[model samples]
Target: MHPPDKNPHDMRTAFRREFASPEVWITRTVVVGAAAVAGLVVVGFTWLAEQALGLFKGIASVGWWLPLLWTPLLCGAIVWTTRRFARGAGGSGIPQVMAALDPALSGGRRPLLVSLRLSLAKIGLTSAGLLGGLSLGREGPSVQIAAGVMLTARRWLPRGSGVSAHSLLVAGGAAGIAAAFNTPLAGVMFAIEELSRTPEQRNSGLIVSGIVLAGLIAVSVYGNGTHFGVIHPGPIGLALVGPGLLVTLVTGLAGGLFARLLLASLRGTSPDAPSRWRQRYPVRFAVGCGLAVAVIGAVTGGATYGSGNEATRALLDSNGHVPGGFALFKFIATWLTAWSGVPAGIFAPSLSIGAALGHDVAWLTNYPYAPAVIALGMVGFLAAATQAPLTAFIIVMEMVDGHGMVLSLMACAVIASTVSRVLSPPLYTALAMIQLPPRRTLPLATAGGDTDDSATRP
Candidate 1:
């Protein structure tokens, strides 16, 4: 029988190869344990973030001008700490994870990009950014924090467990999204679309299991509640099509423009004064950025402060109107916060900006497109910014529990992402490339980021 044909494709052989190894169970157990810890960390991080926002609110209530003093000083302090201690904790933490996952770069820099100290700094400083009334979100930081938490387990895993460090990192990042957003499917999608930028993501089971295990914690705590509560958008009909198309276009342009500006701010294209300041006096630059945010918040009556969570929920529920020019103010505020080099996330702020834009469009058209339009705008902007359309739509769909609008959400995400690609390369990848050691073998030219010879610049 020629040794049963020795077929490599046999299901029985594959099954045995996967389950026969005892180390597989060991690896899975450790991963599960790490995911549980990551979930708890995220939960605590969320609470800390909320408390920071609450503290800021109390301070603002004391006086409108308080943010002017509070935001700038605290931002300067945060920048100083970041530069002094864990600089990797800065930004949303996504780019660091992306950089760490690059096989070419991971050899020497993984420790620098991801570690326990960095995770702790990320949690504290991200919350501090909120405390300073900066327009930042914790979700993006959570991704890095969770990844760091998971990476800590690498030393404990059994050898030959068939799980690479990359798998663990991907699982951790996906788990972070799951815990932060309470969307398991979206978490997996994000791992695939955003986190797993390399070929090392072949272990789908590990990633999926990590997401479920971690996401389950959020579901258990929130009692299966979504980030955005359920809001049923009416059936997709001809009347909705025109409005949806227009919204997609507007959000796409806005999202793409935001991405372009973000890249410019991150890595300057020209010898501009603000760009130079950001690179030279980062702490002072943060103060200026904080002051600018305070001014915007003061003018908008705090509409542009924090992650815009309340604003987004209000827009989705049509509870009340945010001040006029909310989208514009929010766009500027979020950009400034990123430019400040503080530990902050853009997720919720981006959604809020998209929500404001959608609301404005509905109002201008007088088309009675409140909640539905808002949802569309949210998905469009997120997709455009991240250039991860499927993940963007899934996250929104799960958040709003808008199964009724899934098709529309997907279409909007794809269209908006396409528009964004014209303006900028993928946001996380471009930023990650900048973090890596420049090699002559690597591609240097990007769409508009001009990352060519990035290591030499600045």
Candidate 2:
């Protein structure tokens, strides 16, 4: 009687055997294939960006006249593209990612074409912005470009793929940032801190995959060197720690305030509102670029005109005697560059300015351990400015590659972040508020409220 009765499990076993399937292995193969393709695309994009920048540099070297013509025209083109295609690409594009991923904004509606066009627009505009001496950084453009690419690819997938697309876009963007700056950990941290604004992100698996792929691509191309050259152990002292902490707090607060002020100045509705720059089309941008170049050139002799990597190197190495208010000039240049709607990132420029400011503070005050103090300030100010302490700390540590600065960095980061919050929200978040619809923004007037509270917590 027992032998005569076959259980459902036995029937299923026979069915499984009949299929002759290797589901797990096949799935693994598919995953590996997708990852390989994504990795190649990321690397290729980064390489292209660098090449584009080199070409810009070559053209500009011919004469200062090139940028004079190039700045306004290129900026105008970027603005025009943003206006026509991805309205979200109008600013840094990070906020656009946040907006797209926001649950509140999704009325079961995701515009694939908008995303794709935005990415293309970002790449062109950002590259052109770079050529035109905009103070913006490449990380923003890289993220936008990656997001756009992934956005285009997701169009072929099923309808429910929007979430997946968003996650992948965010991951791809992180990879782009990681590759651009050669900071894999920072990339991952950024995805977690800034982009992964939901509980599901823990299991989404996209962040890890995208960051690792991007990091690998960056390392392969850049030979695993830290984005900034390693900092030599330069006169570390316990006495300087106290003063460094104070400076860090000030810088952080200033950074946050500066970011907020810039955002406020660049966004509005009325024709005469502070955000008139958005309405005037390219004219405001032309003026901004002209001013940035003029100020940077007149003050630093063009040394602080472009991205601040080379200048940062020189400043850190020189025991903190960079000329009169060069840091201040660089900060202004970056501010104007971003406010003018150039498609660029503030990541590098912000760090450069923070480092310079820190050094300047230490030098002026005759603070002991000037370099270490300044480095700490860099970490703190950057963290507060971006509202990303962990990413900022990791970035500075990786850039300098010295554990000696860790304690001071932490001190600076914490103080700066605390004070920064008191002053205003992070710059990018504030910028988002200005650019985003009123329904989309968190009430930034009050402090300690999470500006990103609308999105699910990462």
Candidate 3:
């Protein structure tokens, strides 16, 4: 029997029909997959938190040397594992993800392997890094771990399951952020705005669904109230105007300068061409850890280690009360933490430092507007340093329950974000350039032969 000939119109209509239904099916699948992944991330992060807190409490119970010994061993293990198993685990995995998203790197490696190893290493190293009194935050590292999990799933999953795996990865990442901050909405926003903004624009629906489910899990775990019970929402007044604006501007400058200086110093100190400080990565990190030990030990009396979440609680509870220069010490430790190539995050530590500085300002000035200033500074500096004002604002607001200070926070956020942009593009952007592939010109071919348009083609 002869095959029936199909008309162009019928063929086009058929193609459209085929393409249309799959989107709905894929979206539904993504939603369910995201929910499952969110649940998994919540469970994983909760476990990590409990383990970390228990470990730290145990260390605190013992003498000082216990932490020193504990920290180095853990860091050493993590570093060794990363070097041996997955080199992507060395720094904040966000940069690696960015690299992975680039068209150039996508086809090279599965990217999922890098994600999985980074995740495992981050959990072990970050936890251990914390115990060692290293100044780092879990939130940033959590992203790496979450991505790593997704990557592993991709590597081993059935060939046809890639789409579902990608969806779940996005979901897991959002859930990780939610669990880390105990703020689900912020996590969702971050996933959408920052983490999932890829050139391909492939998993928007899956990511959004995952973020929602992850947020629900976070809310269940942390309660509906704000992450920090910041009940004192004062009115916005001229009283806070002068000091608030001044500090915000100053902090913006300081944050931008600080981020640039720290990155530059870290870059310059790379031990190799790729990283002037790469060769010294181990030693530089060790020295940074030693310095963190010294500075945090001396200033906070051992209270300033790890992410400083507890310290932040203590500071806020004390109504902007903190030991003088504690903020500076924390900042220095954070710089060392990232620069040392330790598998960790600077985001939380930066928030902690900003809060400390704001508090210090309030305490010294004897100002009643301490909370506003502290809240503003906490987010302002973060916005400036990260160059993600929206994400910074949302994360900070959710963490501190800064709803009432909206006017002040927003004003400062705008100023600080603008200042940061003006000062430098963003820390990650500069770091990405360092890893950018060399440009190459490939010859372009027409249907019949090579074309001169090759040199001009992007």
- Top model by lDDT, which number? 1
Best model number under TM-score: 1
lDDT of 2: 0.62
Q: Tell me the TM-score of model 2.
A: 0.80
User: Compared with the true structure, what per-residue lDDT tens digits does model 3 show for residues 342-393?
Assistant: 6677777778777877776666667775667778778888888877677788
User: Candidate 1 at 395: error in angstroms?
Assistant: 0.7
lDDT of 1 by residue, 1-458 (tens): 36665546888877887788788778878888998999889988988999999999999999999999999999999988887777677777888888788777645568677777889988999999999999998888989999999999988888776677788788888888888888888888988888775544445676688778888988888778778788857667888888889889999999999988898777755588887776667778889999999999999988888999899998888667799899999999999998888888888999999999888888877767578889999999999988989989998999999899978999999999999999988888888776666664543222112222332444
Q: Tell me how far the alpha carbon of residue 45 in candidate 2 is from the true structure, in angstroms, after superposition.
A: 4.4
Clash count per candidate: 0, 1, 13
Stretches > 4 Å off in candidate 1: 1-4, 8-21, 198-202, 440-458
| Full-model lDDT for every candidate | 0.84, 0.62, 0.62
